[model samples]
Target: MADIKPYTIAIDEERLNDLKTRLSLAKFPDELDEAGWDMGSPLADVKRFVKYWQESYDWRKAEAELNSVPHFVTDIQCDGFEPLAIHFIHVRSKVKGAIPLLFMHGWPGHFQEVLKVLKPLTEDGDGVNYPAFDIVAPSLPNFGFSEGPKKRGFASEQYAETMNKLMLKLGYKEYVTQGGDWGCHISRALAHLYPQYCKATHLNFNSANPPSYFTNPILALQHAILPYTSREQRGVGRSKWFDEQGRGYNSEQCTKPQTLGYALADSPVALLAWIYEKLHDWTDSYPWTEEEVCTWISIYWFSTAGPAASVRIYYETTQNVDGRKNKLDHQGLRAWSPGVKLGFSHFPMDIQVQPSTWVRTLGNVVFEKEHESGGHFATWERPDDIITDVREMFGKGGGAFGVVKDATGYAS
Candidate 1:
């Protein structure tokens, strides 16, 4: 096991100046008459953001705030692959016997997603009868301060291996997990591959396909016979709209991420527009401040790995999308993994939100919550709800109570 080292966020002056230069020289595109979201992110919105990013947003101040958070790094190696220097924020609870919790972030997200829950999840609860956790939220390879692979074929399996090994290296022989988007996919992979160590999981995004008769006859039948809930019906519509109108990025990234990477890497405007669209569309009408948006994008601009490295996971995972050969069977990750307790939070505005029957088929569901609002970035947008779902699933009388042996994370 590699020795763990302290880590901090600091972008040099040259890079900061280059970002400003790029922002100043960015070209503005034409917009259609009153073209709103349907035409992708609006030109007007992009212009407003670019002006703020160049003139008003303070990158130095944002850096100090992010640096205020404690971070650490250690090398994790998977068999056959090279070792990777993984970056993470490790916050321990004041309460002894705190449950070890692994938090993972997905695309268009980084370790920053943990900011909202870092305190509540790790602090000793005041009078509230709930368990505290020792939280480990990593910047998955290529996404944040972490390093990325130059070689190809580092898919979900590799990601799971990286996270699982990190926990073991940190002396967490057993742990639970929480995630959304790619976080959901990676946690599912962890539960499937390392059920012995990863005891349970709570996820926010919809990740499973409808159960099939071959594998899940009972669930498949129930899926066929039962009437969809009003929420489920609305979810179907939301999913359909995303499929038709919002999946352009998915197709492009899955096939030609390298080509797209240039635009993201070289042009600040391009990168901002690309990610800003999702931030707007994927949320539940949450008002985003100018500084918040800039800081979010700035992480990518000044990431340890260049902005381009962040998008390669898309291409690597879906290289066989053309069906020439086998691709990463993402659907396989969603299949039931026994001995692993499962929990899910259904955020109404999340991309690809699924019906209960579909999500329930994912695994041994111990708890679930269907929220009236929230979206893909649920950890940031609805931290309390996500933490509560996890707490309820692992607390006393909860389905996964006493799962981690002597570590129940409660006051004696």
Candidate 2:
């Protein structure tokens, strides 16, 4: 195995300057007199983001902040398969005998989302509190700093296997896994393929169950009746609706990501508007003063990872769905993990899916929770509540057992 090394930011100042010049020269599409985001990112919003990126956004500062975390890159030999190299940040806990935990991120999101939780998890001596655990946040292969996969057939299942290799390379015998969106699917696969290593799995979204079961009469009746009767169920349904409306980006990414990638990959402002729009729509309805949303966009814009990251969804989903039916078959699922145990921390302001029916059919759900506050970006939106839930779920006397392991015959 090749030794892993610390990665340094090496972006070219000239390239950044070129990006600004292109943005300044862009010829935008025409819109109606009262045009707005109903079509997509409004011209005004894109202009604001471009101005900020050109005049105010500091790539070096953001790079320094990201570098503050301890990060490493390692190469793994996958037997006969091509070698896969992985990049990850390890945040150590001040608490003695801390457990190891692996956190994953989904599409349109990255390792930055978890930094809020990472701070409290790794530090001590302040009011911050959490179960002591070594935290590992990796840029999913082909996403951020992680090297792009060498093979063409890379999917969520492949991502799971790669992550499993990553854990084994790091000498973790067992660990807990948590994720949302694509991360949720990959974590579920990790649990299914390597149950011995995956002591427990937790998810934010619970969409892993087979589609056939969703149409089953009993489940259908439960889905229909439950929403009317249960407040949580109703919230889940509403959340689903909101997600569908806000998910235009997903549809585009899953289908024609490469076409759109040309623009996003080249222009920082374009990438900012593309990602920032989702952050605004999905986060808690609280008014995000302009600075806050731009701050998040600045991270991705400066990283120069916007297009590479977006195309991953196209690669994964296109491999799974093709141009055929929406329903996923068992064989198709076997390519990924089958299902996962789910947990929820419902914030009063954020809409969430109910755990009862969702988890029982999905996987072995060992924990379900309801918190007073927080939203989609739990770590960033409400770090304390997220910390509390994570502690309660994975701590001693917690809902699940042992740490997660890898299925590819690798160490935990």
Candidate 3:
């Protein structure tokens, strides 16, 4: 606890003036009259947001709202990498045996995603019927207020190390995880690498390959025997659409993040458009206000490591750097991670909406739920969906019940 200290959101006055100057002098690009969202974030929407952001948005109000939550910062030094200052939100339930839950966020999303569900998750629950959790949501390295690793080859392994160590530092010897996007990847890596410490996981983004006969024979047999349900067929179509059309950002970030970083770092409009596009496209049409958009973009604009630092996670994990490949590859994450209890929540409009059969192949899937609606950012879009699933999964009679040693997630 000596190494961890209380944290607050404090963007400098100079930075606020700088952002205003950039917005005032921003340039706009010509758009196709009827393009809509087919090409990218519409020019009209961008211009409107720009005008609102420059004139009416209040950073001080937004900053105060964010600081209302309990936050802390600590130094975490991964093997062979310099110590980086990690920022996290920590909320401890009054319930003595409440489960420890580590909530992670992915690219284009910050630790703020936990805000909606924070109260419900950490509140006291009935001893025998409902459950409570001690929530720890951290801004991953190179994201939000957290410092980024300066050295190369800091991939999934380093991330898992950072998260695992964070939990251990908090005295959570055993815990479960919930995440989407890069959070999904990092949580899977935690299960794969530190099964003893990470007892279970509940993921919203179910990105996995089909079960192969050689690897998962039971799942493979089921995959072959079952007919594709209409929902699964639609999900597959969605997956294909993402692969063929929605992955231009992936390609660019994985190959040349530095080149793109220039645009994102220099121009506030460019950063807004780049992230705002995903916020629009990835959600289940969640109604977004201009103030909400500005606050979301402002976190990245005024991040400790800067907006440009975040994208390197994609490049570092996918491509070999400094003559060393990532310790935990993406394909390895898709494979079965034994001994770790697994749960998944499938949202129809998610970026890669895979079949339940495909997701089950990843681990010992003790629980699964399919939602009628929701998208990539389930935490923000449908907090109730995640809250229900987590309570059901770890509550009494659930498959993963009591997975975390004596932590039954209820009052003593």
Q: Which candidate is the best by lDDT?
A: 3
Worst ten-residue run, lDDT, model 1?
Answer: 320-329
Query: In what order do the candidates fall by lDDT, top score first?
Result: 3, 1, 2
Winner by lDDT between candidate 2 and candidate 1: 1
Root-mean-square deviation per candidate: 3.0, 4.8, 2.2
Per-residue accuracy of model 2 over 316-400 as CA lDDT, tens digit each: 5555546333223224432333334445555533434544554455555567776554556666777787777777776556665
Model 2 worst lDDT window (10 residues): 403-412
> How do the residues 1-412 of candidate 1 rate in per-residue lDDT, one tens digit apiece?
3388888887888998999999999988888898889888899889999999999999989988887878898888876678888899888788766888999998899999998998888895521357888889999988899887766778877888899988887878899999998988888888888999999988898878898899889988999999998889989999998999999998989888889989988999999999999999999997889999999999998887888888887777766544423233576777778899988889889988898888888788888888888988998888889878888888877888778863332111
Error of 1 at 183 (Å): 0.4
Task: Report the number of clashing residue pairs per model.
Answer: 0, 10, 0
lDDT of 2: 0.62
TM-scores of all candidate predictions against the true structure: 0.95, 0.82, 0.97
Say which prediction, candidate 2 or candidate 3, comes out ahead on lDDT.
Answer: 3
On a 0 to 100 scale, what is the lDDT of residue 261 in model 2? 72
TM-score of model number 1 = 0.95
By lDDT, the better pick of 1 and 3 is 3
Per TM-score, the best of the predicted structures is 3
